[model samples]
Target: MAANSRFSIAVHVLTMLAKNCDGRVKSDFIAESVNTNPVVIRRLLCSLQEANLVVSQVGASGGTCLARQPKKITLSEIYNAVSHGEIFSPHPKTPNQDCPVGKNIEAILCRLQKEIDKTVEQKLAQYTLQNVIEMVEREKV
Candidate 1:
């Protein structure tokens, strides 16, 4: 399965906003940084807003900012906000079930995927938005 770009983009946008927390960060600016279209940024903002990760304001000097302190948010939170499907997905067009392995492989894959998801979630839970921001800062960006 293809990984969603939204998760990475959201993290980048949110990290930028956290670094420049004195004011709101414009979606346009975020789009520029991500090298994507502004519309993409807006769409992403909608999901982040829904997840309570960012708050948007409208006016001459309006933009977006993290809803809570950077330390309060988590990478998993951002991931969940934009990642609509499972971290991994089986083939939509089911594999042929004539063969024993083919029939049982789907079930085995499902179980293994669940285990992987749990491990990933546990690791993600340990890293907050602040941790990400700090890393960005340390990287001199």
Candidate 2:
């Protein structure tokens, strides 16, 4: 299965907004930078807006911009805003009870999955959108 990319894309969109800092950015411009369709960027924008991370406008000069400063926006906040489900999905159908490993696998994986999600969230929470912009600035030189 394809991994979910909404979290990363949302970060990119916000970073762009943080760096721009002066005016609203159109989704098409952000889509070009992200190399994705404008629709995808717009969808992510909707989710971020609902989380109060970004705001949008409509009309000729209307576009999108960050709702708050980059330093106040944590990566995990961005992650939670877009990531809807668990990182790992369980089997669609029940494994055969006839097999001992099959019977216990789901329970075992559930425990592991919880730990994994916690670790990931904790790590992501360490950084903010400002951190990302700094990294980009350093590398751009």
Candidate 3:
């Protein structure tokens, strides 16, 4: 199961905010760092806001800031924010239902997908943005 780039992008945004320590960081700066479009960043910001992972302020000095402390924000939390649908999307094409294996394949695949999602989320929950920052800082030469 492949996850979207939103997870990494969100981590980037949060880590940048953590370093700044200020109330907010503009989305454009974030977009530049992530090498993505400002419009994409804004859309992601909206989702993060809805998840309470981040908040937006309007006006000249307006931008986005973490809703909670970096140490408190888990990667899983970030994953949940921008992830809209299933973590593992099912096969788009329908399989033939005449065969026994074919009829039950979807059910078995779904069960496996759920298990994978749970395990992945559990692992992600162990790391917060603070941990990521520490790793990044340690890697600096």
Q: How much lDDT does each candidate structure score?
A: 0.86, 0.92, 0.85
Those runs of model 2 whose alpha carbons end farther than 4 Å from true positions after fitting are: 98-101
Instruction: Go through the candidates in order and give the clash count of each.
Output: 0, 0, 0
- Most accurate candidate by lDDT: 2
At residue 114, what lDDT does model 3 achieve? 87
Q: Write model 1 residue lDDT over 1-141, tens digit each, in one string.
A: 475688888888898889879898888888899998989998999999999999999898999988999999988788779874366789787788998877898998889888887777777779999998788778985
Residue 99 of model 3 has an lDDT of 81
For candidate 3, give the lDDT: 0.85
**Worst lDDT 10-window in candidate 1:** 82-91
Candidate 2 lDDT, 26-121, residue by residue in tens: 999999999999999999999999999999998999999999999999998999899954877998999998999999999999999999988899
Give the least accurate 10-residue stretch of model 2, judged by summed lDDT. Answer: 83-92
Error of 2 at 91 (Å): 2.0
By TM-score, the best candidate is 3
Error of 3 at 107 (Å): 0.6
Tell me the deviation in Å of residue 98 in model 1.
5.4
Q: TM-score of every model? A: 0.83, 0.86, 0.88
Candidates 2 and 3 compared by lDDT, better number: 2
